[model samples]
Target: MDKRLIKRIAIALCVGPLLWVLFLFYCRPVVALHYSARATESIGFFFMIDYATRKQGMEPGETVVIPTPMFPERDLWILLSFPFDSKDSFEIRKPFSRVDVCIGAGAKVERTEIRHGFFDRFTEPREPCEPPTSKR
Candidate 1:
C-alpha cells in the first residue's frame, strides 16, 4: 500500500473509536445508572404532604393539621407516619402526623386533621407545631 494511504488508515482506526466513545458519553441518554436506581427506590414513597399552620412560632404540644397529596376517593382519611430526619440518608425514627383529604386543584389546603396517640412519642415527642397552611 502507498505510504500516505497507510498513514491515513492508521489514524482513522485510532480516532474512530475515540469519537464513538465521546459521542456515547455526551450524546447518549442523559440518565445515569445511579439516578435511575435512586428514582426506582423512591417509587412508592414519592407523594409528599408538605404543610404548615397559620400560627407563628406555635409552641409544642399544640395540635396542627397538614395537607396531603392527591389520592383516590376510595378512602376519605389517610393516616401518615412521617419519619423525621435532618439528612437525606439517615435513620429517621421520629414519626410525624399527616392526613390525606380532598380539595380542589387550586385550594390552599386539602382539609385534613391530626391524629394523636401513644405514637405521639414517635410523631410528636416535644411541643408539636404544624406548618403554615399551604397557599397553593
Candidate 2:
C-alpha cells in the first residue's frame, strides 16, 4: 500500500470508531431523556391523584411524593409514595395498581403491577362510564 494511503486509512479507522462511541454516550442519552419526559407527561396527574386518594390513610389533601426518573436520561424505573395523613406515625398505605403502571405510551421500559395493602378493600376495576349502555 502507498504510505499516504495507509496513513489516511489508519486515521479513518481510529476517527470513525471514536465518533461512534461519542454518539452512543452523548446522543443516546439525549434521546432517552426526551422519551422519558414524554412518558411522564402521558401519565397524567389525575392518575397520581387517584392513586393517592384511594390508599387508606392518605387523605384527599395529602401530598404524594412521586419518584422522578432516577437517570434523567432513561425512564426505566420510578418510585412513588403516599404518606400517612395523621399526625401520629402510622403505616403508610401502598397506593399503586399494576394495571395503572402498565398503561403507558407506545414504548415502556418497566411495567410494574403493584397492589395496595390492607388499608382498603380491593375495588372492582370499573370500565369508564359511557353515555349510556343503550347507546352502545
Candidate 3:
C-alpha cells in the first residue's frame, strides 16, 4: 500500500473519534438524577427514553448522573418502577435541562428543581422544573 495513504488513514482514525467525543461533551445535554428512597427496601426501576429501556437500577440517596442525547423539546424520557407499577409512566419532562427529582414512596415525584452547573452550585435563583406541555 502507499505510505501517504496509510498516514492519512491513521490520522483520520485518530481525529474522527476525537471529534465525536468533543461533540458529545459540548453539544449533548446531561441528566443529573437524584432518586431518594423513602421505602425501607431499595426501589427498582427502569430509566427509559421513548419507551426503550436504557438503564435499570436502584440507588437510594446517591445522585445518578447520566449524560443524555435526548433534547428537552424533542423527546420524552421516563422512569418506570416495578412491584407497584402504575399504568402511567412518571415522565421526565426536561432531561436535557438541569433537574434533580425526588421520588417519594409509591413511585411518586416528590419534588423537582432546576439546579445550576457544578461551578454555579452556590449561585441563587434555583429554578423549579416546570416543563411546558408538548404538542404530542
Which 10 successive residues of model 1 have the least lDDT summed? 29-38
Per-residue lDDT, model 3, residue 28, is 49
> Which residue runs of candidate 2 sit more than 4 Å off their true CA positions?
30-75, 78-136
RMSD to true structure for each model, in Å? 20.3, 15.0, 10.1
Sort the candidates on lDDT, descending order.
3, 2, 1
lDDT of each: 0.29, 0.31, 0.55
TM-score of every candidate relative to the true structure:
0.25, 0.26, 0.52
Tens-place lDDT digits, model 3, residues 53-128: 7645555654565555534445565554453433324566553345556565555566666654543332322542
Indicate whether candidate 2 or candidate 3 has the larger lDDT: 3
Count clashes in each candidate, considering only residues at least 3 apart in sequence or on different chains: 11, 2, 0
Error of 3 at 74 (Å): 3.0
The C-alpha stretches of model 1 lying farther than 4 A from their native spots are 31-136
Question: After TM-score superposition, what is the CA distance of residue 21 in candidate 3 from its true location, in Å?
Answer: 2.0
